[model samples]
Target: MILDALFFLVMAGLNLFFWAIIIAAVLSLLTGFGILDTRNRVVWTIGDFFYRVTEPALRPVRDRLPNLGGIDLSPLVVLLLIQAAMLLVAAIQGYLIRGGVYF
Candidate 1:
């Protein structure tokens, strides 16, 4: 039971982080298109918040990725990684169930 609860919690956390990344990516697009005014404090604050949240996870990927003339693929890569992690969690849960560990 405890293991199941912990797994649920971790899955929930991962799902939330996954959404955060999506939100950050969307916000980036809005900023890039100039539809959002970053000079405004509200816009700046929101943009900065997303940046701080995502940059840590994305920085290493960004560093490893070769520059492609202002195109950034790190967010897409991170999203793919997040999807893989979610799949991994589901696989582990299935494995435990298959092994007859009824947690």
Candidate 2:
């Protein structure tokens, strides 16, 4: 019972982390392309936070990936990785539930 609870909590945490990455990626793309202006202090702050948090992950990807004209594909690659991780987690959880395993 406790194991089941813990598994659910961990799954929820993963979902939250995944969504945060998605949000940050979107924000970074928008700000990078000038679609979203950081005119207001609050906007700048939020955008800056996401930029800093996501840069460590995206920078390496950007460096390895060849530039396609002027477009950046690093964020798309990162999003795909995040989505794959989430799907893998869900599949593991489903398997555990089906096997009647609490953990």
Candidate 3:
């Protein structure tokens, strides 16, 4: 029972992390293209926060990836990696549950 609860909690955490990355990626693109104006204080605050938090993870990928015309593909790559990690976690949890392994 405890193992199942732990697995669910971990899965929920992974989902939240994955969604944050996805949201940050979309926000970055919108802000970059000037489609999202941060003139308002709230907008600016949210935008700034996400940029500061997500840029570190994104910078390395952005540097390694060659520029593709005007569109930056690094965020897409990051999103894919995040999804992969979440999927891996879910798979492991499923395996443990099926294998009757409990901690």
How large is the C-alpha RMSD of every model relative to the true structure?
1.2, 2.7, 2.3
lDDT of 3: 0.79
Worst 10 residues of 1 by lDDT: 94-103
On lDDT, the candidate that comes out on top is 1
Number of backbone-clashing residue pairs for each candidate, in the order shown: 0, 0, 0
lDDT by residue (tens digit), candidate 3, 1-103: 8767877887787677667677887887787889888897887888888778778878999899988888778777887887787788878877886887844
**Top TM-score prediction, candidate number:** 1
**In candidate 2, which residue pairs clash?**
none
Query: What's the lDDT for residue 45 in model 2?
Result: 93
Model 2 Cα lDDT, one tens digit per residue, 1-103:
7766866787787666666678887787788789888897887998888777778878899999997987878777877887787788778878987897844
The residue ranges of model 3 lying beyond 4 angstroms of the native Cα positions read none
lDDT winner, 1 or 3: 1
Which candidate do you rate higher for lDDT, 1 or 2?
1
Q: Could you tell me which residue pairs clash in candidate 1? A: none
lDDT of 1 at 73: 92
